[model samples]
Every structure is written in structure tokens, then in C-alpha cells.
Target chain A: MHSPGDKDNGEIEALIQMMSRLPGLGPRSARRIVLHLIRRRAGQMAQLATLLASVAESSRECLACGNVTQSDICPICQDPSRATGEICVVTDVADLWALERGRAFRGRYHVLGGSLSALDEIGPEDLRIPELINRITDENVTEVILALSATVEGQTTAHYIADALAPTQVAITGLAQGVPIGGELDYLDDGTITAALRARRKF
Target chain B: MHSPGDKDNGEIEALIQMMSRLPGLGPRSARRIVLHLIRRRAGQMAQLATLLASVAESSRECLACGNVTQSDICPICQDPSRATGEICVVTDVADLWALERGRAFRGRYHVLGGSLSALDEIGPEDLRIPELINRITDENVTEVILALSATVEGQTTAHYIADALAPTQVAITGLAQGVPIGGELDYLDDGTITAALRARRKF
Candidate 1:
């Protein structure tokens, strides 16, 4: 006969499998993370649960810049001080968060949902290219920073964006090539990000 | 006014806050984690959500051992293969995970929920001490491995459990000294944990 607590084994098993899908996390790690969360429920787990429920309901892509935001515009775009006529474009929200952690950049950001995926049929339309063009004139953006990944696709995308915005007369720039930042963000110290941001140059 | 996808800010904010609460993670990291999860919704986030929802609904305390599981009797307790007449008591599930990661221990584990905290008003009843004592003879346990931290509270709790189990004839042992673990990273080289496990001494 199954007991009261045993009833949730199926649920826990499903949860473990789901957690296993996370990046850098496998089924074993997923089970461990879930167990840890459950054990600390009153403090960390409860708060996480409420947040997960709410975010699962409220999270959406920003209409203008494509940043993950709770509102139509991300905090960076909404902030008046950040509208210094500069829009730093990045591949994903993780890169945006890395920039934010450095706290060195004063301008805003435009997240390009993803890089141009040739094998995956991802093109400019698949990204925020059009929205970025519209935002330039609409918001008096004087400069566009191509803070994309250093991968082949990232560079191709950067060149594509630079060419697309060629007529806009905007001061286009990209993060420095010597700084080494594309796939790995968690490993870089805060100061390295700050340095890279400081040394960004025209694309 | 209202953008097409501007409806879910509240949920996103809640998720960001929850992610921030994780150890070694902050607001920025949480935002990134949420965004990463969202982008992979089909294969990752959806599964994670379902798992979280179900685990949130069904998780409970392991009545006999204090391990957080989905049943009154945990898998370790119910497993006939684990009926080796030995129980390795620990402070939390993380320790158990650490032990499992090593693939060293063959017997079952009894999590203590937490160490006895005088400052926190935690006594023997607050932990699974009495339950652990009851399992000694009932399970015909030959040894009790006190796989607890080397902290003052951990040592004290170990001593208390050892003292409580004194009436029984089971051999009581503990994890060795000079090896420290706070369950912060959980990424120690397997050999280190294995060495520590092998070097374990009597309490």
C-alpha cells in the first residue's frame, strides 16, 4: 500500500527529469537541486515557488528591445538616464545581465533573441533587427553597440546589423576582439567585463 | 499603451527575485537563469515548471529518517537492498548527495534535518535523533556512520546522537577530521571525497 508522502514520487520523478533539462545540469544534478529546494522550503524554496509561479505567468519578451522584462520595456530601456543615444545589442539576456553586473555601461541594451542560425533557418527577421532599426530613430539613439558573441555567426550577425543600419548615420561599435567574450560569461570576473565594456570600439 | 506581450511583468519579476535567492546566485544571475529557462520553454522550462508545481505540492519530511522525500518512508528506507543493518546519518540531503556522488557508501542514510542549535532552540526532538535510535535495533543496524560536518554544532550533534545510541550494541563511527565541507559548491574532485570517506574514524 502506498503512503501519503509516497503519492508524490511520480511528481518528484517528473520534476527531476524536468530539472535535468537545465543547462549544465543532468538528471542527477536535477534530483539534487530539487531535493535541496524541498529541504529549504520555508526560507529559500517557498520564495522560489512563489517567484516561479508568478514568473511562469508574467514573463514575456520586451516588445521594443526583446529583453526579458516584467513590463513592455526592460528597466534599462525604461530608465531615462540610460537613453544616452546608445543601444548595446547582445545575443541573449545572459550577456545583458553580465553587462549589468559590471555596472560600467551607461547606455541601454537591445537583445537579439538569438544569433543568425543558418542550420536552424534563423535570419534577421528571427531576431530584433527590424525593431532595432525602428528604435534608433524613434528614440534618438545616436550609437548602436554590437555586443554580440565572438562566434562566426555572432560576427556575421554583427556585420549584417552594421550593414543594415549603414543608412541610419549611427556610430556603430562592437566589443573589442582582444577581450575574449562569446560563450563563457560565468567564468569571467566582474572587472574583466568592465574592462571589455570600457574598451569597446566602432564596428 | 499596451504592447502585445506586455502582460507578464509581475511573474517575471517574481521569478527574478526567486532566482536571486539561490546560493552563489544574485539578482542578475536569477534574471539570467529565468531568461535562459524561458527561451528553452518547450524542452526545458515547461518540464521545469511542471516538476516544480508537482514537487511543490507533494514534498514532505521522511518520517523515519528526516530526509526530504515524497513519502513517509523514503526510498532509502524502503529499498530492501539498503537493509544492510547500517545507517549513515548526515546533516542534510546535500551531504547524502555528496556521498552518493562518490558512489562509495553502500548502506542507507538518515538525514538529521539539521544540527542541534542551542541558539536556534533546536533539541533532540527537533531532529530525527529518537527515530534514529529506534531504527538501531529494528533494522538490526551493525554500524552508524556519523557523516556530519566538523563544525562545533555538528560535532555536538554527533556526540548527542552517539550518546543517545549508546544503549544499543551497534558500532558508531564518524567522518574523519581535517576534511571540511559546507555543501557550497558540491564539485570536489571525487578522489577527495572518496579519500575523506575512506579516512573516516570512530567517534
Candidate 2:
């Protein structure tokens, strides 16, 4: 950390080195993005710092779904109208927003936190799979939509969940979104997203 | 800012407000992202924060191309192999990375900082247009590949630049990525990216 009087080249180098470690960002890009944010600190960076600190203390995971929330339960789970007997499942929180962007889905969501990965040792216990089953009976859910990725791991996890919930007789489906050969929900366009949702067929 | 004894609500709210302002992120996504980062602070989040701080200090705009850099010139400009006499002109630093991911182009790049927009009182003077004109001759740049988005503003800026650098005798081409109507480079796949790059034609 730089002292009050030490805004020198060394300090700057240290900062850039640290920033390079961020996900989706390399050292070169990190250095660039950080500088841009800092130059606008008077208008943006300072505020980002303050928010980072505060959110650090106040936020938590949704108890029912894996969605991140400030309160014990996320807003989506709290809304009575959202309990539409259907819970769309996703890999990460980012995917949830992609669906929300089109303002289409009205049902609630159950974030898996991550997919079933044998290599990473990520199993059903690591995800919200157990909780998802419980929600089916507790919420009188009729369908469990699997809006997961089409990756090897993603499909594997989807099949596992389907088998797990087979006893409940719930209609399982996926986002017929024509998700590219290998793509995340985050990158799809609004129209593609709309089409994917509309064409969603039963799995 | 709050004293040690103050309740944490205000601090948390402040953080949410600042995060809401990030591109493609609103209060809700910001809150979730912040929460996710905090929960994994010891692992991923810690690394991200440390890196954020590091880049914040060392990162600066490349003197030659306006790309983010830790020194006078960015690595792209510094690399001898990248001097392919073709300089891809883009709207921002993000676009540069998107281009890099495609790995189809062997040329250096120029970050215009932003597009020319009269609605926001932004003009040629507001962007790096003057610098771009200067680079054509300085770098012996044979081509200026316009890889901007399909937004009305993006096209307008591209056209404006093509006209401004008319006398430079540089080949003025745009990425024919047939980029979806409103697609961004970041959202594209490597193959789609390559296709677009390969199909590029004269402006």
C-alpha cells in the first residue's frame, strides 16, 4: 500500500500488478482499466471504492435460491406473483440477468451457484440441487426449467438434475435459445434471447 | 463516510449507488457482483481487489494510440511484429480486447476513446480523430480498419474518420463482421470474429 506521500512509479507498478489478477482481465488490460477509472475518480472511482467496501459488509446469498441478496431471501423469491410453479435454474448470477434483460420470464429462479464438474469436485452438494427439489414440493412448482449452458459439464449437470427430479413428475425444459456452439447466457442479443425463450422446448 | 460506531446501512447503500453506474450493470447486478466478490474475498475477490488497486496506480493511456498502458506506449505499439502497416481504429479499449480475442488481425490498433456524437456535444476534437490522422503518416499505416459497432453513432463516427483521413492515402476498411444489428465486439465468438475480420471490405 502507498503511504500518503508515496504516489510514485513504484506504487503505480504495484497497483497495476495487483489489478492484472482479476478475472477476464490480464495485467495489460488491468493497468489500462484501473487508470481510466482512477482518472475519473472525482466522478466515478471514489464512488466505486466506497461501494465496494460497503457491499463487502451487507450482502449475502439468498437462503432459498443461490442468488446473491442483501436480505436473507432475494427479491425474486419474495414476490408472491413470481411463485408461478416454475423455477428456472442457472449456473451463475450473470445468466439470470441475461434472461431478465428481455423482461420475459415471470417465474422465480434457483441459481445452481455452479455446474456439476467432476474435475473441479463440484457436485450436487456444492450447488442448490437439493434445495431445488425441496422448492418443487414446498412451492407447488409444476415445471423446473433448465436454462443452463450447453457445455459438456453444463449438459451433464442438467441430465443429473432431470434424473433427480424424475420422481416428482415435474416437466423439465431448457432454453431453446440456439445458444451458440459454446456460449454463455451473458453474451446473447436481446432478440436472440427473446427467440430462445419463446422457442424453449421440453427437455 | 461513516464513523466506526455508525450503522452499516448507509455505507452499504452508498456502495450500491456507485455500483449501479457500471456499464451493463445496474443496482441489482452491482449488488450481486459485489456480494459474490466479497464472499470469495480470500480467493478470487482478494485477488481482484489487489489487482484493481495495482492497475489503478500504474495504468496510463498509451501516448501513441490511447490504449491503456503502464508506460509511454502500449505493448501493442511496442511490439515490432504488430507493425503490419494496418491500424485498426476502434471506439474504445474494450473493442481492442475483443479484436485481440479473434486473433485474426496482425496489425496494431488505435483507441479513439469514443465516437463522434453531436447529440452529446462530442466532435472530432473530442475524440482521438486528430491523433488518428497524424498516425496514418507517422506509422506508415497502409490501412485503417474501422471495427466499430453498428450503432448509428458508431457508423457516423466511422464515416467521419474515413472522410477526415481522405488525404492520407491509407486503405480505409471496416470489419465486415456482419456484426449483428446491435452487437458489441465483446459479445462475439472467435469464429464469428474471424469471419467478420476476413470479410472486411473497403469503406
Query: Each model's TM-score, in the order given?
Result: 0.72, 0.54
What stretches of model 1 exceed 4 Å from their correct place?
A1-21, A24-33, A72-87, A97-109, A116-122, A134-143, A149-155, A168-203, B1-14, B80-84, B98-108, B116-123, B137-145, B149-159, B170-203
What's candidate 2's DockQ score? Answer: 0.08
In CAPRI terms, model 2 is classed as incorrect
Choose the strongest candidate by DockQ: 1
lDDT of 2 by residue, B1-203 (tens): 22333333344456656655644446555556555575674555545544454555456788898876666777677777778899998888777867887889988898888888888999898898899898888889999999998888899999999999888788999988558877877667778878999999999
lDDT (10s digit) by residue, model 1, range B1-203: 33344343566666777666554456655665677777764556655665675566667877777666776777766766777887999888777767777877878899887889999999999887888888898888999998877778888898999898888978999877436555321455566677777887877
- Candidate 2 chain A, run of 10 with poorest lDDT: A1-10
For candidate 2, the TM-score is 0.54
Per-model TM-score of chain B: 0.86, 0.84
Error of 1 at B196 (Å): 8.0
Clash pairs detected, candidate 2: A15-B54, A15-B55, A16-B54, A16-B55, A18-B51, A19-B51, A51-B15, A177-A196, B177-B196
Model 2 error, position A92 (Å): 1.4
DockQ of each: 0.26, 0.08
Worst 10 residues of 1 chain A by lDDT: A1-10
